[model samples]
Target: METRSLRDDEVMKRKLLIIGWDGASFIALDGLIERGCLPTLARLRANGFSAPLNSTLPPVSAPAWTSFITGKNPGKHGIFQFYEVNPWSPKALGRGQRTHMAVPGVVVNSRSIGEAKFWELMSAAGLRLALINLPMTYPPAPINGLMITGMLTPPGARQFTYPPELAEALPPYEIDLNPREKDFSSPDAQFLRRIRDVLAKRTRVALELFRRERWDCFVVIFTETDRLQHRYWHIVDPRCDASEWAHIEADVVDVYRQLDRALAELVRLAGDEYDVLVLSDHGFGPAAIKRLNFSALAERLQLFVSTGGWERNVRRAFNRISSSKRRIYKYLTPLVPERFLHRAEAGLKTLARRGVKAKLIKLHDYIGGVWINTTEHPGGVIEPGPPYEALRTQLMNRLAAVRDPATGKPIIIDVRRREDVYHGPYTTAAPDIIFILDDEYGIETGGRSSELILRIPQKNQGTHRREGILIMSGRAVRPNVQMARANPTAPGIEDVTATMLYLADVPLPEDLDGRVIEEALDEDFLRRRPIRRCSSSRRPSPDVASEVWESAEEEAEIRERLRELGYLE
Candidate 1:
């Protein structure tokens, strides 16, 4: 096994295909595979290396997928979540006085990503590329080959493809399943239908592109997996009552089966010449048994102080009305007029937004981060330095102490200071304190209820986990290898990009947090093509200003989509 440099012909001939199944986990996949339901994946696992890919800190899609493409952590990528706190808003001033209001600044877009994606680096290295339906890729940028943006593309956005004319060449495609059709409270046949339809359209586009595109590397992601698991986990989870959802169980499984077929088709099209890698941004699990209202808990602990004023009174009134409305809707929705109910809901939302002010600590719902209101904001109650550190420490301790009432088990698994987990110039933009909740619990930041802990309903019984699935099989990969057995630390989402770059014979970027997963590669392949490195110091700094949505309507549309997907309340 003599080491040698990859020749130009070898580099040009290397082909890699990445298929991302957002929120896929081995817990579900293994069970399905054992049942022969996902034969393609089963075959892939049997023939090649498989491992659990660790997700980002919060285990959410936005950051995890971004990390996957950039081989960087959330701090380095500058996309902590779907949204971030806007401390500079004039609304924070509130008539020249400090008010306790949380203002979500903007929906994160492609421009928000701080690092160059692997495709960009590969393109610069003279590799032909095809990127399809990759999330956080909205506002598509020019690349070496072609690109089709994925999640967060505003509904009706015309510029979802690069070169502007590629959209015309492709079949009618959707960025994602319409979020509005999701209804977790009941079995939704319509939702299932829409997902299947979307899946079909996506598969068609992917297959068509793969057939026509001439490229060294092609990457495409299917987000419907994450969407289905989020809403229909109850159908698959054995712990949930089967009687109510048993009828739809087969239909749900069929969705996965259809996905399996689609995956097989894609691989068949890729041929033996291409190295195939299938992965997920994060894993899926039973939704938490209880919800932790961070804002309520902070208030209970007195770490979050309300600036008592007329606005506070108004907020209190709004809460009472909102609570009463929920109670009424719970009992009267069947009897009430639909239009009336919709108007009432709209009115309440307006009231809630206008009446509420910021507290000392803001709970960012989408990102699952807690920001300390320091002197930088309008109503900064806590001073920067010692006070900030003390508050964070105290909050972390209190959160760690919380226990589930029914089980008497700790609810929080870990609480970390921002600095402990994140590094880079954008670190300060992150929450001062980041906490990880037990899988049995989910955090609720909307302050919809005063209770610190509320039981989760069965309908909403799935959420993200840290361990996603990764399967690598190709001529260049080792057979029958398990990543965990090969290495103590499992491969992470970030490592996927680095591994792909290495396989494509591109030099690894020096600034990347992820390293090539060498154990999964064939001994001969590694010996013949030694790894290479290049300085990425010329890349843009993470602190470079990010672009925001040009119009309020676009921002609103994205917010609604996130809310429908259960990312926001």
Candidate 2:
């Protein structure tokens, strides 16, 4: 009996699988490959095309991921920072308390984001897509297919957005920031083995679902490379330590090899049944640590009160004051009765209109830019006030003046308005101030935990590097694409969304800030999308600690194996 081969031209079977790895840098990739470690990745590169993937400015995960999904900049998408505004008065928002409440009339969490995300566009076009582990998608929405939230949301939070009739027949799904806790904690050898096992398992689940359910496009992510690099860069660098470095390098190589093997398996399973596209949101690299005290700079400008030990005392005092106020607010909120809350809120809004600023004192010591309340940006209650603009300029100038004592190099390399850094009409409540640290230096503002500052020993031992990689191969991907040609320097991280959407034959939303990379596709490829629709689908279960301890036991074995392999000691 002869068996038919599944091929890309089959037309009958058309789908796309996208795997997003967090912080998989081309810098790390080159090192691993030159050392003869990542054969599978190297082979894949030989068979396809790969280049440095440009990341978002500020080089963080949340904004970059959002841009990748929405094809818009932070200005357009509005998720500028990790924490949102305190929905209640500042007095009510404190540490360990959820700061922002769902403000009435605001359906989406971030006001900066525009509608027309990748899945939404695809679903509306009538194509079924499975989006697994994409970040910032918590509180999962009603989708045409599966929508498992990624890491930023708290664990075990996947709630089904589709109805029971639509969801009942789907495979059980589980999602988390990092799903393999036990294996993650294990040693090198076992960790590698566990990663392989998990990849095999995840791939199997995805394939089975694809075949049984008959979905059009599917995407699953693997973030293991990112996790390993953050903890092991010192070990892998040739210019670093001499004695123990060699052993660590071997372990790092093993991770690359494992990912390569996993890719091979995915390819085998996909078997031309779908077009495969692998990408990293941003690439990885060598980073150094540097602490900067913003309050110290503030003192130089006389904005902050500082004594010999005044900074520590001030932080403690602020924490206490903020805590006391929140507890009182929380207590009064219920006691005053439901009817009074609205009336009080209305009165407060009236007071706000009359220019009665909230009594809460903000030290203005935080590292990020403050939003200047002005007619230019509405919904803002505070402005620089009379002393504001001058004070802001003076402070920005002083921060720019800071330099490394030893090297005499400037600490802040650039300080631009958020509007200047990002381009789009959907601007954020722009930070009143913006400061960029010297490469490898983290802004360690004063009023930080004593443990964070006093405990960490080495300076310039932090992370912050440019030069991430981008790789693309599969249906209609142009061959021999070079990094310089395929990606121009300083490409907005959001461009990935437009590029992917174009590949999937989805129409570009008019408001998107990014343009599709038309040259990246083969000329003969059709841009017309296939017709498909999702009847109903269930959100995957949130990851739970398995009742079966066998996997946990296996994880323990892996950690020990890693110790011997010198990945961790």
- Residue-wise C-alpha lDDT for candidate 1, range 85-132, written one tens digit per residue: 444543122322332334455678888788888888888888888898
Model 2 worst lDDT run, 10 consecutive residues: 98-107
Q: How many residue pairs clash in each candidate?
A: 5, 27
Candidate 1 ranges with C-alpha deviation above 4 Å: 1-13, 85-103, 183-187, 238-243, 304-368, 405-407, 446-450, 456-459, 483-488, 542-546
Model 1 TM-score (2 dp): 0.85
In the range 1-569, model 2's lDDT, one tens digit per residue, is 12332343245334676777677766566667787777756665666556666766545555667778778776666554333322232322232111111111111222224445678877877888776667666546667877655544343332432333423454554443243443245565665555555555555555565554545667767656555655565655455553754665565566667677767666666665555666776654455345554434433434322222544555555547545745755778777764465455333323323221111112111123433334333243435556556655666676678676666888678766656777654354335555666544554432322222222333212133444655666666666665652345534456667766666656566666666554555556644333222232212321112131124344344334332322222
Report, for every candidate in turn, its global Cα lDDT versus the true structure. Answer: 0.75, 0.51
lDDT of 1 at 167: 94
lDDT of 1 at 215: 72
For model 2 the TM-score comes to 0.67
| Residue 366 lDDT in candidate 2 | 19
